[model samples]
Target: MMNVTRGRTPFLLVFLACTGLLAYAYYAQFQLGLEPCPLCILQRLGFMLMGLFALLGAIHGPKAWGRWVYGVPILLGAGWGMTTGARHVWLQNLPADQVPDCGPGMYFMLEYDFPLMDILREAFTGAGECAEVDWSFLGLSMPMWTLIWYVGLAVFILWALVVNSRGSRPLEQ
Candidate 1:
């Protein structure tokens, strides 16, 4: 039991980290008045997915093969976020004239009953609004920071997996 609990530490940490990030995102949106663009919303979803998987993994605390099951989804979530972040960063770096024209807000598109594919296409294509670097820390934009976090979290999970692979001894009765 102790060994199992010990193995869950990493998952719990990941979950907590995700929670903090999400909370800060909300703070940025409401308090800081930084509206999230379409790509930002998608990035948030990815973080949510990763956090959900990490929470489940911690609660389950399964040994051996079970780790792989949870780890895969977490990695997928991270990859999803990383890809979105990369796209956002690329958009931000584009020359002024090259930036795509701003599109309708996600809410507006949904309210108007736009096709799902169309919504996705517009979001991925990245509007002029998405290219603006409104928020930054230490010279890195929000998307750049998100990309760094995704990569860092993925690496942490991978390290945890490797460490857990070394079989633990069963507790004595």
Candidate 2:
């Protein structure tokens, strides 16, 4: 039993570290004058809530009912992320003028190597439009990757729930 308990510690550590790194990224954007888009904001909220749930579950020590407690947050976060990703995908298909200006200039994407001419182009680009599905890395759009992330999180959380449930079973069973 103690060995099982000790094993959980590493899981908890990774969870905290991942969540903390994401939080720091969000904080950096805000501090560096890079406003987050609507999807980014929503994802951040989900991550924060997930972090809280994990923190609570760690403190509670994974009792039977505590499985339910931790499980809910991860599921909720996944739903939130899914919605954001869908919205982003929709925006990528809309006409230029119809897109929503979720935030300020494209400077938030300075890391993208947008040239002076490109900046001028985006000055006319409007907010997030359906026409511009330009952002991609590893051949996946930001929204597409976010969708994968949310689904992956959901799977992992469910796995944790299952593991915790099995651990609580009686030896006779």
Candidate 3:
């Protein structure tokens, strides 16, 4: 062992937790029975990118550029999350009789690889209807949470990035 101390563990833990969440979200959609919309896909991308940045920072040590790398995904993920949340809000605001079609009709995503493209295709085109909120937990709908999480994740990522950046600068003795 390299004799890693307690101080370093928290950062590692946070990285692992984020990575796990991203992995689980993707698995839930692809393996289980959830299909994310375009915005959902964007969120996933954000998570994945963030995870990658964190992993690099953790393994190689938080370097000069590492903070910016991490921040990029965090901001992107946050933006995507907002879009998803807004989409849901739009749907919620619509009248029962006037709900627009939110169904995925993909002739684009299908142009990629088989397994993922299939999954992507299903994600957009297969979800019965986009406007209909199919599920909710506690008092909030999934999209609502997605929105909250997006804003929250952005803040968190920024915090993490700042810490990493500060840590990167050597202190004057």
Candidate 4:
């Protein structure tokens, strides 16, 4: 059996990580002048959802089944982020001629009163802007990094779930 902390440290850590990621994203957008496409915006929302769920779970500190209630949304948010990240990566890898045409910006769509579903459909289909690799680290683009982060966070959540499932007792006195 695994020994787990009764306190909400693990969940708190996850929340903090998500917050840090979002903070960097804003920094990249504002300071670095990286314009986020619609898909990027969606990915940000995914991170926000994950962080929100993690914060709530940490605050509630529920055991057993309650963890599942929180875990599901966190996983869902990760999955959403992964999906968008994958799409963005795919777009980036597409040949120049094969890339999708650039579409209207999300703000423009909203201001022009485009239907909600149409906006989502266009966003998911991806635009030329999403394919541009304006930033990279260790040869991996931002979307690739985000994909990795989502996978890592999901795995961490799973491990925390298993460890914390053992008992209600704190791992340390």
Candidate that scores best on lDDT? 1
Pull out the clashing pairs in model 3. Answer: 104-124, 104-125
Rate residue 88 of model 3 by lDDT: 58
Model 3, 41: alpha-carbon shift in Å?
3.1
Return the clash pairs for model 4, or none: none
Deviation of model 4 at 118, angstroms: 0.9
RMSD of each: 3.8, 9.1, 6.4, 3.1
Model 4 ranges with Cα > 4 A deviation: 1-6, 166-173
lDDT of each: 0.89, 0.61, 0.57, 0.87
**Candidate 3, which segments miss by more than 4 Å at Cα?**
1-14, 23-32, 63-65, 102-104, 107-128, 163-173
Report model 4's TM-score to 2 decimal places: 0.90
Off by over 4 Å in 1: 1-6, 166-173
Candidate 4 at residue 143, lDDT?
92
Q: Which has the better TM-score: candidate 3, or candidate 4? A: 4
Report how far residue 124 has shifted in candidate 2, in Å.
23
Per-residue error for 31 in candidate 3, Å, reads 6.9
lDDT of candidate 3 over 1-173, digit per residue (tens): 33221233423544675677677677767787776655456556655655565566566554455456545754765675576567655666668776654443433455544467565545434433555664567977666766766676667666656655566533458
Candidate 2: worst-modelled 10 consecutive residues by lDDT: 2-11
Considering lDDT, which of the candidate structures 1 and 2 is the better prediction for this target?
1
| Two-way lDDT contest, 3 vs 4, winner | 4
- Name the lDDT of candidate 1: 0.89
